[model samples]
Target: MNSFLSNAKRSCGEFLSSFKISQSTILHMVLGNNSCDLDSCVSAIVLAWFRSQMKNGNEVYVPVVNIERKQFRTRTEIAYLLDHLNIDSRNIICIDEANVRELSNVGKGFFHLTLVDHHVLLKSIEYLQTYVKEIIDHRPQLIELPSRIKCNISLVGSCSTLVAEEMLKNKAFSVPSVVETLLLATILIDTSNLSVDVGKSTPRDEAVVKQLSGKRTKDELNLLFRSVADAKFSVSGLTTEEIILKDPKWIENSLETIMMSTLHLDVREFFAREDSIDVIRNYCATHNLLAWVALAPVINQFKPIALYCEDDEVREKIIEKLIVSDLLLVKTSDEDHARSDVKFLRMYNCKNTRKQVLPLINEVLQQRSSNLSA
Candidate 1:
């Protein structure tokens, strides 16, 4: 176990335990995005540690995982990496119902926030937007933050890359190898082992891996990537519902709501599972979603963009727009010709991700609504 992570674990526990609403010192909270993936959690944990070690950095920093602590197990890769470092996930500060209320009640000017891995403030934490002191993310700036807040937004494969740069810039640049390995592993997994074919890796991401990987050979790095990715994509014990909820991204428009989740297993195998269809329908109903989009990654193309919706007209319109648009959708060979209830399409434009698809889907939905009004 690296000494820094050990210290971080202890420090996070101590701070949370000692935190009080009446405490004189403001709680400097470092938080990641709601998804709480490996990159998000690592960035939060490491960036908080880095800031706390600076001169005049006596104000304690607490790394807060933005999800409920119970959901920590659902973040398999995060759990695996922390456990490997001998850092118990239980020791981490996670957002719970009680914690949310407690922090929300931390009177104005009594709390400070640093956002990582995400820029836009969601409704859950919008109350703390004015209290935000720093913004660090690798995505396009989506929200207008206060002028006084220090912004470090840039385009990179992983937000971890930006956090790694911060760690490197510190004068007292003594970071533990376990911490380095954690950052490197996150960048590798997010960038697909920094493969040129995947095209997600930027120069900064590559540099982080090259520098932090140390004497570990190419094979060692590859093994590390597989270990983390295996944990990330592993669904051995998870039920179908758990798999769908693992990394869900919600898309809501005035006309409808759609739930999109990454399918770690093969799409065909997923569809064949018992009660899978019922689960999708129930999930949609429970969340008031009009549809569900299940995406599975392929080596060269995004194969099998699956859609589950009972509304034939709505699903077909979205499909038609995608087929003619930049996504370059084509029907799958394994498409069930008899199954009119589901639609499976392939996308030739492998570079575009959900970030790009979400807007396009929204546009399609908007147009359909306009045409109906017309």
Candidate 2:
């Protein structure tokens, strides 16, 4: 009855007629990072958009992380839309921890398969590429791939926002109030509330959030902020080594001595609990280190405040000064600020920092060698 819903119906009819996909065709809805709000929002938008375009008896499959992981929250949104349209639930397939190899083999006979994701896991992308007729992502790598795989990359704030914008353009699904709220939450979480240090907010995300939560209360913003802050670091059952390797960039540099530098206490708990700094120092003391850097990215007024230290003493001295300078500071007995320091090295993609720091570390190694010779 509303303009948005009417437009959604019209768009779905047009797309179904255009694609010529029959009611018997199976539609696979693959999602990544079920724990992430952005992923959940994107999955809902894509499923709703597709449902609008199809008729009865078509199948929709959703791949979840685990049955108990609560990835199926998107199902509620999907149900809302489907119920409005009088669609049946029997046609939807919700698979959890699915074996990709097995699913591909099973879907081989199906006429149409579509995959949507924002996560940049290479292995998952390759697997989906094998059978997925269409793929949507914001990762630059997906855009670089060959043309046969239908890939759309907009580099927006959140992949869910991107999909919603696309649907809005095509007049596909009704942009429901809840869908809009989810999109706004995803953008805020992903962009660190549009802090410049994390990178500027994507225009698309900004526009959608503005359109959805017009004149949001301060309490609402605070609640959203808390939700994201709580999810930023997960340390349960994780070793110091495991935490370091969580980022893919760090995994690639596992063989080399990577320099991690952070403002002293940010990762003090992690380094101390895992005993990683000692491990790193011992390893660097023995092996040939290819890279090393200490980068302290201080958040001052929502911008990156960088302080570079090439030597351990220099870093310690600076941190002491910082503590004395009225900045709320905590010192670590573990002395593994280097681990958090190096973690950011991979995060900001600063290869040049490694080039600068390694030489200084090597100098320290050589100075110790000269002292031993004396």
Candidate 3:
């Protein structure tokens, strides 16, 4: 790992060593989004490292992964990339391990927060909204923020591009080759290696890649992108539960929550797992998941979506909503789901990502809640 990151890592370790509610020290942290994907993780870690290197004042900087500590290992691409960079994952702060709640409860002034990869705060941590000092995200601005907060929301392939620009603006050129390469990797992943066909890559993303990928051949970066992308989908060692939580997207609303887990393996293989139903139920019960969106990409060419719900009535309502939408959902039963409590559906819609699916599902959940309240 680079010396800057190494020092930041040590600082994080030292901070945790004596963390307490009564402690006088203030923490300035870069917090990734709750989803904690590769882009979010990289943005948080690298940006924190950059800030600490600047040493603006007596501030103590830390990068926080916005997930449970255990969930860290399940994020394969993140684990793999950090390991490749020689960064010790143990040194990083995961939310479950952080004293964020204790600190937040102490007061909003106790800590300063900079949100990366996402603008809106998760409901669980919305209590810290007043402390949000800055935001760097690629998504369009979702809501208004206090004039005191510095918000940099724009359309781009990855927030990494924004961070990379920040680095470049402030002579992050002195940043290690490894860190720059890592940022390059994130941009590639998010923009599908700047693939025109993917169309996720913005001109800004391409410009950043060109600047950072000096001397590195196109073929080499392509190989690296493929390797990381494959690692992202390889659920080799994860258990059934981990598989579900690996890239799980928790959709929350006023009265409902749903989990949409994206998997790269065949839907049949996931269905074949011995404890699939049990794990699904456990995950649902914990979150009161009104529905489960099992989105598995088969052979990287087809997408099979399965919606699971224990309540047959709720399941039918969700099915009705999905079937009527543009998702082109076709209920399929390759296995014997006839006797299972959790209903399943197989829809082959590759073009529509969670960006489209989540809102549709949320509408169903919201409408259902409204009906129940009525």
Deviation of model 3 at 29, angstroms: 1.0
TM-score order of candidates, best first? 3, 1, 2
Q: Model 3, 218-266: lDDT tens per residue?
A: 8999988998998898899899999988887776666677888887677
Best prediction by TM-score:
3
Off by over 4 Å in 3: 1-25, 140-144, 299-301, 327-349, 368-374
Candidate 1 local lDDT, residue 71: 68
Give me the runs in candidate 1 sitting further than 4 Å from their true place: 1-22, 55-58, 253-257, 299-302, 310-317, 327-334, 337-339, 362-374
In candidate 3, where is summed lDDT lowest over 10 consecutive residues?
330-339
- Candidate 1 structure quality by residue, lDDT tens digits, 226-302: 99999999887888888887776665444566777888887878878877888988888987778888777763455
TM-scores vs. true structure, each candidate: 0.86, 0.52, 0.87
> What does the lDDT read for residue 321 in candidate 2?
43
In terms of lDDT, model 1 sits at 0.76
For candidate 2, the per-residue lDDT at 166 reads 65
Error of 3 at 178 (Å): 1.3
